[model samples]
Target: MTRAMGRLLDDAAEGGRITPDEALLLYTDAPLHALGQAADVVRRRRYPDNIATYIIDRNINYTNVCVTACKFCAFYRAPGHKEGWTHSDEEILRRCGEAVELGATQIMLQGGHSPELGIEWYERIFAAIKASYPQLTLHSLGASEVVHIGRTSNLDHATVIARLHAAGLDSFAGAGAEILVERPRTAIAPLKEKGEVWLDVMATAHGLGVESTATFMMGTGETNAERIEHLRMIRDVQDRTGGFRSFIPWTYQPENNHLKGRTQATSLEYLRMVAVARLFFDNVNHLQGSWLTTGKDIGQLTLHYGADDLGSVMLEENVVSSAGARHRSNRTELIELIRGAGRIPAQRDTLYRHLAVHRDPAEDPVDDRVHSHVSSTALNLVPVAAAG
Candidate 1:
């Protein structure tokens, strides 16, 4: 490391925060390896233990029909279109049952912004899920959904959050926050809520004692300054509300999407953003790496770059898969990757509670059922043709 870079790291480690200018230099000027090293130092200071964590959860996308025609989204189908569909309550509950059977402690109930589903629709569904599986945490929705609910129900953001909380909405998955910059946000997700509106909804939820995490989508043609600006926005909000539990950054997958693979972020850029996120978001407590988007190798490399969480061994994922991300890994594979990175792996619940720690790698549970399945099987499935 250069003398200036060493000084910056020393100051960051000694209780001093890096300025936005320094962060810009790190993002644009610093070498990739040096950035990773600095971020690793920050990670050690925050979490000294050698153990990294993973969550056991499933993403249950309720519907793909949406009114908002976000350019970057490959998951949503236009409302009333032939491809549009919503899961029945029974089907949703059955999936929840499967997740619980697979030892999942959390269900991320996410979907598109359907105009037909009103606030009452969410209340009833959430209530039914809670009634049946009271132990399962409903870590679902994002600010965009909340904003839609508020508009649909003719209530304020706080009212929507409170009602959802009453209906067993435990937390948010921090979806819909692609870039948090107005230009790129408008460019990609024009019909969705604005960047500040998303933050406002989160702030309102925090005020009502409903803590949630924040997310950023990198490689959407956003500049490095804009990425740091995104973190600064979240950090400023965390400074006041302190409701953000973690900050997760993932790369944008652009396949089978409306953008038509216009631009995609590289693996190195993804790691740089992750490292910069840890260095910049000093107030945030946790940093999660997205293996689903970045793949296993980059995922392991992230552990040394300020990431303490390996995201989730997703029992199922639809959003990214719909967007052409096919990377998949089972529980044993994830554990091995973490171990290879020289960190102990622990399974965690939705609330970050350690359920079980795998100290002996030899004893890791083996499972080989990890693969991407179509989001809509009934409509999209094709029967195999037997050849004579």
Candidate 2:
């Protein structure tokens, strides 16, 4: 490791946070292998041989009719458009039932910003879900949704988060945070909430005793400085509230989106960010590798770079599918991947509770008949039965 890289790891080990300049050095100057080594050291220090964790969850996009018109999102259709859709509560519950049957303990309730659905709409839906499947954890929405509800209802951020929490909204998914820099955020999602407002809402949520994860959308033509700036912003809030549980940074999927194929960040850049985030965000507890966007090999590689969590099996997804991300893996395949990376595989709940840990690498399942299917959305692909 370089002198600066060694110092950076030592700072994190000594409970001293690295400066933004140090973060930039790690992002730009540190050798890839050295960076991964430092990050793995940090991970081992935090979670020793505990196996990279994954959650079994389903992303239930309740609707796709959005008014925000984010330039990079292809999932939303304009209000009143014939193709726009909103799932009935029954349809949503059925999907939840499917997830529950599949041993999913978490449900991600997310969708576009529909003016028709107010705070009361969410309250009713959450109440219904909780009343029916009281065991399922609802890890839904994000700072942007909080901002939207507050603005739409003319209530403060605290009121919106408080009311939602009371209605059984468990935690924020840290979505809607494309890049926290004002320029890139405005360029991609101009009509949505401001960068500061996103953080403000999260802080409010944290203060209300509602913990959440913080996220950044990488590879959006942002400077390395801006990327570090995003981490700095989250770290500042974490210093105050101590409510962020994890930080996840994923590359932007460029295909079939409005931005029309802007330069995407390479795997090297993504891994560097992963390592830098681990080195910089000393307070945040977990770092997740987004295999869904980066593919399985890169996902396995990320375990060495301070990512102790592999995100989720997804069960179902639509947002990235709309943008042309096609990576898919089953539970057995995921376990093998983790084992192949020389780590044990553990199934975790939304709150990082270990439900089951597979220790014997020999127990990995082999399913040779598995085949990938192309879903209607770019991110929703699944398997189809063979023709008789």
Worst 10 residues of 1 by lDDT: 379-388
Question: What is the lDDT, from 0 to 100, of the residue 227 in candidate 2?
Answer: 92
- Local accuracy of candidate 2 as per-residue lDDT tens digits, 174-219: 9998898899888888898888989998998898889999998888
Q: Runs in model 2 with CA error above 4 Å?
A: 1-6, 9-15, 362-388
Q: What does the lDDT read for residue 378 in candidate 2?
A: 36
Model 1, residue 182: displacement in angstroms? 0.8
**Which portions of model 1 miss their true places by more than 4 Å?**
367-388
Model 2 is weakest, by summed lDDT over 10 consecutive residues, at: 379-388
Flag clash pairs in model 2. 321-378, 321-379
| Structural RMSD, model 2 | 4.6
Summed over model 1, clashes come to: 0
Q: What is the Cα-based lDDT of residue 15 in candidate 1?
A: 44
